[model samples]
Target: MIAIGGSAGSLPVLAELLEQLPASIDCTMMIIVHRLKNVPSDLDRLLSLKAPIIEPEDKQPVLSHRIYLAPQNYHLLIEDEGTFALDYAEPLHYSRPSIDVSFASVAEVYGPRALAILLSGASKDGAAGMQRIIAAGGTGFVQDPASALFDTMPLAALELCPEAQAMSLTDMVHFLTELKMSAEHDQ
Candidate 1:
């Protein structure tokens, strides 16, 4: 499983990633982007142009080769039974669909099999979750602070999990390409 957390200045970065990704991958990808309460988002539609993306429904099974976007106003969570669960809990870091909540849950469920990427944002929401992921033996990656449009989020994540590789956007694209190739080869 792969979980990507982002806020502020992250849409363009995500767009770039999706634009460069392979047509298919062997794992499920969950995208957690901080969004305003009650505001409608076209993120899923926008990204679907580049890949098979959707705002998942509660209890929907987590399936490979699809990208799941966290819907606005609710925290998107992964269940132990490999399904999705939406939460109406209080916001974290002043954001619902909190990146931290999603990351933490993914780490707990997927452990070493999980891969997390923290991107540009103005808040510290993803730092502790990245730390938890690392502690649980998952791989974590942070956008290079210097290149991020909003560096705060990446910097915070790096501070907590210095071991998380900090990569430029270009490098991240290449890394993901390689990952996809490897997965295909294994099959």
Candidate 2:
């Protein structure tokens, strides 16, 4: 699995990443972006231009090669059984669909094979989760602070996970494009 989390300045980053990604990749991509509880995911619709995707619901079975968007008001968790479990627990970082919750689950589920990326945000929501990913032997990356409109989130993640690659928008796009190609080639 490839898990990504972002907040304040995340929409454009997510869109650009999606646009560069191949129509199909070998693994699932799950995104948790901080959003208001009642707001519907218009971003999900916008991103469908690139690949098959869904705003996951409770008990939904996870599918490889799909993009899953975390819903508002609920923290999306990856169950050990390869299903999704939505939680309404108190928000971490003052937001539901907490990035840390989602990323940590991905780390636990996929371990060394997981790839976790933290993008632009206003808070440190994903920092600890990035730490968890690295500690679990998964690869970690963060958007370059210079490329982020709001640098705090990425900066925080860099501090916690110093081994994470700091990627600019263009660098990240190129990396993921090549990664998908390599994974497909290996398969």
Candidate 3:
């Protein structure tokens, strides 16, 4: 499971990442962005233009080579059985569809198989979740603070999990592609 969480300056970065991903790459890709409260949003359409992005249904299978984005005002989670769960619980860090909530669920479900990516954001929403992933023996990728438009989120993650790889957005895409290639090779 690959869970990416970001806010503020994340849309462009996410778009670039998706645009660079190979169509044949195999893996579950999840994205959580702290967006404003707006119904009938076009995020799924915008992101799906680059990749096969979906607003996952409850109990959806953990399918590879597809993209899942958290719905506005809802927390996206992976159950222990690898099913998708969308919750309407209270917001965390004043952000619904929170990074921490989603990442923690991924940590509990996939453990070391999970990879959490904390991207550019204005606040510390994703730090605890990145720490959770690390504590579960999972890998984490943090956007380099220098490259982030708002460095607070990534910096907080690094402070919590200093061993996390911090790199530029382009390097982050390369890292993800390598992971996909490695997985295919292993299979």
Candidate 4:
């Protein structure tokens, strides 16, 4: 499993990452992006050009090669057996669809099988989440602050977990693609 977290300046970075990644890449991808209150979002439409996309329903099973977006006004959690659990909980760090909530959940659920990516954002929302990913024995990737449109989030993540890999969007895509290929071969 892969959990990617971002906010504020995420759109272009996410789009570039998606565009560079192959659609057939294995592993389930769960994305948590901050959105406005009760706003109806169609993340699938925004991302479908790059890969199969889904707006996760409660208890929806997460599948490989498909990207799942946390729905608006809810926290998305990863469950055992690669399923999702959505909740209407109050916001964390002043944001609903919190990256920390999602990353921590995936960390608990998949442990070393997971990879967490922290991208461009204005605040520190995902710092603790990326730490959880590392603590759970999962690989953690943070976009290099130098390359990010907004650097605070990535910088915070780097501060929280010094071991987290820092890469440009292109390098991150290459790393994930290589990881997918290596996992396939191992399987």
Candidate that would win on TM-score: 1
What does the lDDT come to for candidate 2? 0.89
lDDT (C-alpha, whole model) for all candidates = 0.89, 0.89, 0.88, 0.87
Model 4 clashes, total count: 0
- The per-prediction CA RMSD against the true structure, in angstroms, equals 1.0, 1.2, 1.2, 1.3
lDDT of 4: 0.87
Q: Output the lDDT of residue 137, model 1.
A: 94
Q: lDDT per residue, candidate 3, 55-141, as tens digits?
A: 988888878778899989889998877788989999999999999999999999888988999889999998999899989999998
Model 3 misplaced stretches (Cα beyond 4 Å): none
Worst 10 residues of 1 by lDDT: 34-43
Q: Write the per-residue lDDT of candidate 2 for residues 1-187, one digit (tens) a residue.
A: 8998999988888888888776667788999989888866687788777885699989999998789999889999999999999999999999898999998998899899888888999999999998998899998899999989999999998888889989987888787888888877887
* C-alpha TM-score for every candidate: 0.96, 0.96, 0.95, 0.95
What is residue 92's positional error in candidate 2, in angstroms?
0.2
List where candidate 2 sits over 4 angstroms from the true fold.
none
Candidate 3, number of clashes: 0
- Please report how far candidate 2 places residue 69 from its true position, in Å: 0.2
lDDT for 160 (candidate 3):
88
Ranking by TM-score: 1, 2, 3, 4
What digit string (tens of lDDT, one per residue) describes model 1 on residues 1-187?
Answer: 8899999999899888878777776788999998777766787888786776889899999887789999898899999999999998999999998989999999999999888999999999889988888899999999899989999999999888988999988988888889888877887
Candidate 1 residues lying further than 4 Å off, grouped into runs, are: none
